[model samples]
Target chain A: MRVLGVDPGLTRCGVGVVEGVPGRPCTLVAYYVVYTDPADELPLRLLHLDTELTRLVAEHRPESVAVERVFSQHNVRTVMGTAQASAVAVLAGARAGLPVQTYTPSEVKAAITGSGQADKAQMMAMVTRLLRLAEPPRPADAADALALAICHIWRGGTRARIAAAADAVRQRTAASRTGARPGAPGRPGPKRQGGTR
Target chain B: MRVLGVDPGLTRCGVGVVEGVPGRPCTLVAYYVVYTDPADELPLRLLHLDTELTRLVAEHRPESVAVERVFSQHNVRTVMGTAQASAVAVLAGARAGLPVQTYTPSEVKAAITGSGQADKAQMMAMVTRLLRLAEPPRPADAADALALAICHIWRGGTRARIAAAADAVRQRTAASRTGARPGAPGRPGPKRQGGTR
Candidate 1:
């Protein structure tokens, strides 16, 4: 699956695209930052960010989008801007008819470095190693975006598998409750359906 | 001036439009709430808000837009959503080429009740009285939105006057520094431009 990850902010928003499935090496498509002037009014800044994000979604055409979930526990001054930026990103993806998911900072760190408490340097190193890039991505925000995309690619696959398994179990349980053989013609017992989730 | 006030939220967004000048009784153009199902995903909720806000701006054609500024000091669990909704509200106004201004809760209260610490009941009372409504607007959110609009109309007028005064002072200062009469020939001595703020 191709995923676009967004590390949202007002001054600088990071976006990265990657393609892969679980247990497979993801290929980097692109990474960039959207910058807004601090001196500008809030509405103008938000509008610019939204315009850029919408354009990027149209250009990249990622199957799904992942955004960094913002928390108020962070810097009180900057948390609101982060949340606003993430909202624009999610809206862009959803408006394009794509599924949007948000991952916490710790989740991204754990997915990239195998530890939720991993330091930035460790996460950067792993991202570089995984993408087979000759050098680390510049402007930590861009690296963070790439990490989020990779994490989503991996975790999304796992979630889909878990959901499919649950569905199968549910079907079997229903068949047993009905006291009919699975897919029986007389009872029209529940049958296994393909995963569409 | 026609002003649109937005009290943004993910579940219920309040909006109101008022028409009047500063120090005059403002006329209520309309007031309503846009609601999104809490069960809906974040992206969908935000998109719905953006759509409704955009449509409202187009329909009302307000000269300016006012939104309640979200603060992180509020309930931590809901602050992020509030910030996101406010962002969408601001974007809607800005996208339509309207000037968008944000007033804090205290600022709105003070403008309405002459006290920053005014309670909700007082605010609703003032809103009903100012608009000459038969009764208080239904849904506290709707009342809050109308209050915000009234505040903007009054405060915005004050702000414009202050800006104009400052501009005049600046022009005089420039004239003295240049050793030329204001608006004189050759020097162009900083003509007194009409307020466009």
Candidate 2:
């Protein structure tokens, strides 16, 4: 599956696309940083971000999008801007009819480097190694975005499969408790006639 | 000027429109709450909000839009959702080519009830009285949205005028420093050359 990962920011939003599945080597399709002037008004900055991201999504056509979730920082202003940038990324993904996922910084680190508390240098080394690039992506944000895409491909797909399996098990348990045959034609619970989730 | 105010939330987003100038009685053009199912996925909820807010802006065609600036809350999850919703609201305004402003909750409260620490009841009462509504708007969020619109109408315009006057003073100072005419054409620094901002 092709995944587009976004490391969202107001001044510089990092975007990277990777193509791969779990347990396989992923290829970096493209990477870029969208820049906006801080001197511009907030709405204008957001408009620029939205326009650039939508353009990138249309060009890349990724199956899924992964965005870095904004965590609380000591600077409320900074956090607010990050959150705004994240919203635009998520909205762009949704607008393109792609499933969007968010990974926290720790989650991305754990998935890419097998450690929740991995530092920036470690992350860059691991990302460089995994993508088989000659060197690390510059500007740190680009590496971080590429790492996020790799993490989603490596770990997010597996997590989703496990969660789906658990859900199926839960459904079976509920059906058994209610004395209904599994996959019955017309019991309650999601008719499954022609509805798409 | 007509203003559309938005009190953004994940579950129930409040939207209201008011018409008036500063130091004048404002009329509530409309007030409502947009609800999203908690069980729905995050992207779908945000999509709904974006669609609805965009529709509201198109139908109302307000001169400006006002959004509640989300402050840091004890609950990180709740604050993130609020911030996301605020982003969508602000984006809607920008997309519609309306100037968007944001005010803190305490600022709205202070503008409406004459105290930053006013209770909900006091805010509701003041909103009702100011808008000439026979009774308080239901669900509190609607009332808060109206109060936000009124606050922007009553304070934001004055604030803008003050800011513009300050800018003019700064420009005059700069011109004096460089020994140029105060309002000379093509003299750098916001030449008033059809730049809307």
Candidate 3:
């Protein structure tokens, strides 16, 4: 499965594409960055993000899109702007029908190394090593995006798929018995549709 | 002398007024908190700030207004929003004809306590003791605003005031030289008529 990792921003968005597989190392297929001019209007910057992300998704055909969760408190002003930028990234992923996942910085650092407080330089080095790229990621944003992708791969997303499959089987068994979704303990189960009538 | 400190934000602004002889001691003259609904459009929020700040200036009649300096990482998404908020606060003070001074968080902390890394609660405690307020400033933002005011009071706002005065003098001289009033800097630097003639 191909994965698209995004480090979202209003001005600069870092994008990385990697070939992901459960229980196997993923390969970094390609990466590119998009920058919105600072002089651009706020809404236009968001539009630029949407347009570029749409192109990236179509071009890379990634099966999943991963983004970093918002952390406000760096600065209130900044946090608000980030909220807008992240919203655009979310919308783009949904439009592309790619499953989207968000990882916190701490979670990504923990996944890359054992420490949650790993600095950007450390995280970048780990990402370079993990992806085995011929060259270290050029810009900080690209390395950050790659780190986000690696985090999702390790953070139980793979197990969630198995759990979802198991849940489907359980639901099928329960429906066969009741002809509908299982009812609460005290309730008389969902009433029989045609047969009761 | 009376000092008014402002913790400016797009959605909320916390203002504190302190009055007394700078060397002898100071008293908490008044304090305020205004919250603008973030859901409002950006321009409306800015207009709201203008009205509320004008009201604060009128009611408190502060001789000086101390504002927080925006210091964030060079992240464009964060800095742009902060710059806008800071600009609004600066204009508010200038419009009121009150000398405006700004200090970074560390500057405030260093002035209050002996350390720059002092936490919010520690700063508030010191501010309460300094102003001899009947109660500790309630909200953290209120405490921060008061701290800024206290910083300016302890260290004469000489640095900022001098800079502003110099800027004013420069502008006036240039305007007289060109025989025209002007606007922001990006516009043609006051005409070159006086120099050529």
Can you give the TM-score per candidate against the true fold?
0.87, 0.79, 0.44
lDDT of each: 0.91, 0.87, 0.71
Show the colliding residue pairs in model 2. none
Which model scores highest in lDDT? 1
Off by over 4 Å in 2: A73-77, A156-197, B73-77, B156-197
Compared with the true structure, what per-residue lDDT tens digits does model 2 show for residues A1-197? Answer: 89999999989999999998886778989899999999998889998899999999999999899999888753666787888899999999998899998899999999988899999999999988888899888888888899889998988678767777777766766666456655565465532222111
Task: Output the TM-score of candidate 2.
Answer: 0.79
When superposed on Cα atoms, how far off is each prediction in RMSD? 4.2, 7.2, 13.1
Clashing pairs in 1: none
Under CAPRI classification, how is model 1 graded?
medium
Put down candidate 2 lDDT per residue, B122-141, tens digits, no spaces.
99988888888898998888
For residues B103-123, write the lDDT of model 3, one tens digit per residue: 888888998887999987788
> What docking grade does candidate 3 earn?
incorrect
Instruction: Output the better candidate (2/3) by TM-score.
Output: 2
Q: Give the winner by DockQ.
A: 1
Can you tell me which runs of candidate 1 are displaced by over 4 Å? A163-186, A190-197, B162-197
State the fnat of model 3: 0.00
Instruction: Provide the lDDT at A194 for model 2.
Output: 20
